[model samples]
Target: MEETRSQVDWLTRAVEALPDEMTFDAMQQLILSMVFLRQVSDVPEGEAQGRPTWEELVGQVAGKPDLVHQPVQRALRAWSGSYGKFRIDLDNEAVLGQMRSDSRVVDRALRDLIALLDRAGRAGAKGDLYDQCLARFSEDRVGGDYYTPRDVVRTMVGLMAPAPGDEVYDPACGSAGLLTEAARYVETHGGRPADRTGPVLRLFGQDINARTRSIAAMNLILHGLEDTLPRDIGTDNSLLHGSDAGEKYSVVLANPPFSMRMPLTDAGFVFWRYGPPPKSKADLAWVQHVLGALKADGRAAILLPNGAAFRGGAERRIRAGLLYDDVVAAVIQLPSGLFSHTRVPACLWVFSKSKRAHAATRVLFINAQDTGVQVSRGRRTLTGADAERIASTFNSWSKHDAADVPGWCRTVALEEVEAADFDLQPARYVAPVAAETAPGEDERRVRELTEELYEHFAEASRLEHELRDVLGT
Candidate 1:
């Protein structure tokens, strides 16, 4: 854990130094170059004798005249000397040069670099070089508003408890953070890293953005997900351009892009389980896609806008279908502004094909809006403790005879939801408590005094205006 933290720190620093305008693909290339340079610098002296300094190597292929190659060169020399017996050869130079010069070369380099780093990480290397590499790249490129926060990912992973044999997926995966987190969860939960085989071979994801698909693939590889390689990590524009009717997974977790639209074609017909989402609003469309992608026993967690809970029109029918089908498990209200890029209040919807020990007629609702701690001046986040509390609540509620905690959570019957127009908002069903009122006499006196002061101020302002008019006359 300490090593992971350190790697994350290094990644943060590396990304901080990179230009924010860099695309995910460009950032991946830069990371690949950095890793390759570091590896080359680690080679023995006899092998690396003819290798140029880092500056010279970068200068030779950077395709830019203004880039200061000298500093890089000096840094490389100093680093190599300090580390001892570091070397590079012609093949290494060619690889490094190609990675720096062309984007395609960088992609190949990134794949190879990640494969190497994965082997090293599993072998118990000093720092998580692969994690740092990806973190640095993510830091450089600003992700979308839908980018899932790491803490949220951790919490979701914990709640889902992805096992070794589970086939995890994210239909609208953004950089595959949830997928990577799921992989980590499996590894930590008594699953051998070497047991990369099994039904778990299925680590599926799809995204509308090609760049994001590539980034997601890279993210998966960085986290030691070797099963989803060059091909299985689908980047087909047609999939997003068309429709994917027959896809399923054991575990599905996603935070799809909020409030986006797509053309409705025959491909999109498969997502009409709850009726087609409005062309103006694709929120329900994504939900339908997730539900359709689930196996008979699959469990899914999706982050959705608050409106999905009670919106009228097509969305309402979708909500009705979800409740009627008994796939909805829990609805967790997240804190507002949890997303760094947007201020929309979000919620987590957990769905299951097969109800656990609890009745399918009941749904767990947790109001976690006020549970998170303020991380920045105006930004709040769920701490590990808060996440654990929420997860515990959900897990407990999954079992038979789960009790409700007043003001925090409740398990409402499906009939109650049906009566309430299938509204899933926690606040709607969770009874509100009456606040203690101040003494009546004191409150009345204060109100009277406040009204008197307002009258006096208005009169004074009127008199002042009159006096000014008189003076003008």
Candidate 2:
């Protein structure tokens, strides 16, 4: 924990050292790319002996402050040849060229950052540090697009429960948080071979954004995953284009962009089975793409907007198709504000191609809407305990010790789902159960409720007067 704090402090100082003209996007690229370069320098086989490593480059910068770009670019190119290209393009004028004349500024920042990382060593809490960078960017409201809060990533990973030898894929890999967490899950659970030559789990990921994919690559490298699984991340549009022909995975985890619109013609690949999702919303499109990407007997945990669970029209039909096929496994509604910069209520949809006999005919609905602890005025996050409880409930149900905990979780059969016109929203099925409370607590609740009621009554009275005046009555 202390290591994590120190790393964040180092990152703050590094960011502070940068020039004010650097946009968040450029700063992100610059910092993350340098970090990646620093890591790659440790591997001896990347280039012939004479080429300068990260340390050498930092030393070289002290003499000729203007000479940072070319050396870094050359090292990046040579290493990329030995260990496949990471696409952290130094040649991109937008990133480094904007400050080429003021190269001393950029060089100084890199020197300071690399010095901190070097002192921290190879095993520094780099993944957490990278995530902190992403979170800080999200707080600034510029990076929420690709940053999935780490807690949310952990919850999704726990549900998937990735194992050794599982082919895990994330269609919308983002920062590759879900993929890396899955790798860590396997490591924590202990099945990796002592003499492991290749990855214990085959991890693959695809994202539409190149810069995000670069971040994902750097993240994987920082986790030491590149040693076993080099260049596993790609820039494929999982929805518009299919993965390398006929490829499939045993586990798929994703938090795809919510409420994204797509051209109907572009999304026709997965439409034959699930039908085309509405152009205004690609929520179900992502779900179907993941389902299609799964191998028989595969399972997935996907996060989507709450509306996808109960929304009408094309999404409704798609939900019906998923339910009828017995592929929809569970829907866990998370609290609103769980994401940093957005207030969109999200839910996790666990899908299975082949369910065990116990969960084969039913879908588990978990009402974890009230489960998170507030971390800030507007942001909430699930604790480790909260995530474990949700994972255990689903795992127990899958293993046949199914119990319907009132207001929290319930395994509803296909018939009950059909009876409700296939509304998979947890609240629609799991009614809130009041908990036993102390007398003082109950009194406080009653007072709060009374105040809320009066507030509603006052609003209703104001609206009535406004209506009367508009009608001249």
Candidate 3:
């Protein structure tokens, strides 16, 4: 791991050394594109025998400095056909033209990147390099919607418990984090290996940002999932556009952009059957989309702002519809500051198409708002133990063994939820653990408090009587 970090750091420095004219977005694309091109060109020894490697191209650039941009562009375009096309503009001479004066710097950066990858060798296929690059860049970017923290993704994946042969989908798959985490979770739990030999689970994702969608493709490729069809991981607006109505998956995981306002005109009315979400807020719109995209027995996990749990009007109607359907399985309220971009408290809404007989009429509420440990000034994450605790509580409930733990988790029947007017905030229902007291200790404490109060009352009366006598008429 240290070695990988060292490599990433060196490559990051190379990117940093570029001319000032290059934007962060351009620089990011340049670095990732180069890394991806190198990985693709490295088609093993004796394979793709005639194809020029990134190393050979860079070596030739030293002799013919003027030809620096063309060869690399051609190479990337050539390799893109076999892998996937990058969405950024490589032909934009305005950016590439600016490098003419700093050709040597560009050449050195490319060479250094190639050397780093050469040292990385076959391990580059594992994607740690790319993952770290995306993370490092994302940390400094403004709105961090493009990257979901790995720990959060892990917790969601752990709770969902996807298995082999299950079709998995992420509607707002920023950099494909959720899908990759799900793949990793399956591998960790003794399912099929996440290799090129056809992944055990069929993974699918869609992102609206073309550049981000491209990044998702590279992410999947590096994780030994290059064989996934292009159509499966697309750039369509998932809310308004999706697979045919008959198409659905057994597992879905998503962390869509929060509080985004977009036109709902393109979306089918079927998705809004329960109610149309307000144009100013699309949180519940995303919820209904996920619910509609599930198979008959599908299970899903979604990360949304806390407001979705108790918002009024149309949102409440949707919540009621979901409850009546008995599909809302669990709502685990997460800690605040879990995201760097926003401090809006978030929660995980787990849905099940077919619930067990014991849990069908009930919904599990886990008040984990106080569960995580602070990792930095304003960021917190769930430790493995934290994640396990949440998952175990849900597991226990699924097996009909759930017992309410004050201030933590509770199992509420449909009737109780209705009585509460469909308020799903776990804190409103899960009581805090009462303070422990010894036998008869409560009575003794109350008696002592009562005597103290009586003494104060007597003092007040005596003072009033003395004042009245002094002012007597």
Give the worst 10-residue stretch by lDDT in candidate 2: 81-90
Could you tell me how far off, in angstroms, the CA of residue 42 lies in candidate 2 after the best superposition? 4.5
Could you tell me how far off, in angstroms, the CA of residue 431 lies in candidate 1 after the best superposition? 5.3
For model 1, how big is the CA root-mean-square deviation? Answer: 12.1
Q: Supply candidate 1's per-residue lDDT for 243.
A: 23
Q: On residues 1-473, what C-alpha lDDT tens digit does candidate 1 reach at each position?
A: 22345435544544444444555555555564455455444445466666654334443434433433333434344443212111221122332343345444444433343334334433333224644554444434445432577778877877788886677777777767787777777777777533635534346666767545544554454455655432345544322332233556788888877777756554635446778777777777777777777789988898888988988998889899888889999998888756656567888899888997566678999888777777554457788888888888887777664778887888899999999998999888665454566769778858866976686699689989999999995
Model 1 misses residue 254 by how many Å? 0.9
Judging by lDDT against the true structure, name the best candidate: 2
The pairs that clash in candidate 1 are: 43-87, 44-85, 45-85, 48-87, 48-88, 55-72, 55-73
TM-score of each: 0.69, 0.83, 0.81
Query: Candidate 3, which segments miss by more than 4 Å at Cα?
Result: 1-8, 54-71, 84-95, 98-101, 112-125, 193-200, 228-230, 244-246, 264-267, 431-473
Off by over 4 Å in 2: 1-5, 42-48, 61-94, 100-112, 115-128, 193-199, 227-232, 435-473
lDDT of 3 by residue, 1-473 (tens): 22335655665666656666778777777777776766666664356566667566656655666555667766766665445433333333445555547667666655555556556545544577777777767666657868987678878988888887787888888899888877777877888644446545777787888778878888877776654333446666777865433369898899999978856476454677577787778888888889888999999999999888899998898899999999999999888767867768998999998899989879999988777787665567787788888888887787675777878988899999999899998888876566678999989868866976686699689989999999992
lDDT score at residue 274, model 2, on the 0-100 scale: 74
Candidate 3 C-alpha error for residue 305, in Å: 0.4
